[model samples]
Target: MKRALLLLIFAMPASLSLAACAAAQQTQAPSLAKRPIEGRFDVAPPAIVIPPPGPLPSDLAGRLARWEADAASGQQAFAAERDATAALVAAAAGAPVASERWVVAQQAISRLTAARAPLSGALADIDRLYIERTVDEAVDGLPDIYALRDRIAEMESAQDAILQALSAALPGQ
Candidate 1:
């Protein structure tokens, strides 16, 4: 009887350890098979290939050319105003109270603000043109419009940021 009791004590731990190993194996078996099942059903779709877009119509191209010219001139005008304002501010700092240079600085700033109006208008026209073109292409079931549309949006955002910065940097708020 004592021999049997001694055998039971040692065998019980071995049997428990064996059962634990089997349970671990059963859980891990599903994970090992899961990868193959997932791979079989999770096939990726084929890549889409978009064709190149055609050139803009002559009239639209002309409009874009004119707007580009306007944008260039507007940049030149803004730079001129910025240089004049800087000079006037420097002069006003050394001059006596209530200097005329300060007034000229204000005028330069006003001119800068005025110059942005036509630029903003030209940008809007460009945006409208691109949007219309994009929509037209979409109706025809084409994907090439995205590039032009994105370009226009990027340009509009950059120009708008410049105008905002100029407005903020103007002397006296």
Candidate 2:
């Protein structure tokens, strides 16, 4: 019984010392990294931003300057490109049916001409919008509101036809 008491007395101090050590470690626990960005194990850098389109042709500066002018300018660009393309076709050797190509070119010219007045009408709408700040207000008792609407429609249709013809003319599939 005396020997057992002595063994327990020795073991008690060692056990207490171990408990104190564990408690100290718990108190001094290291803090976690607050932000995930600090340790970016798998992250890459940000991508570049591209600007909105600018004038394509050097002379196209005037066209892009004012927003309302865009349609009229676009029409001019279409005609110019069509003429240049037609000239190329006329000059090209053994291009099947140059006469047919020229006829198509005339049709494009007619379409562009037809598109011009409507485009001008759209510009008028823009001008009205500019003056009045709202299309609702601008459209009140307007002399030719229908004509302005017609022009916007014409511009859309003409733009589509131009694209379609160009797509057809582009070099083989």
lDDT of 2 by residue, 9-55 (tens): 99999999999999998896777856777777666868888653332
Measured on C-alpha atoms, candidate 2 has an lDDT of 0.54
TM values, all candidates: 0.51, 0.30
Residues 32-148, candidate 1, lDDT per residue (tens digit)?
445655678687888898765555555555666677766667656665666665565555554444457666655665676676555566667766765776666632312323443
Model 2, runs deviating above 4 Å: 1-70, 87-143, 171-173
**Which residue runs does candidate 1 get wrong by more than 4 Å?**
1-44, 94-101, 135-172
Clashing pairs in 2: none
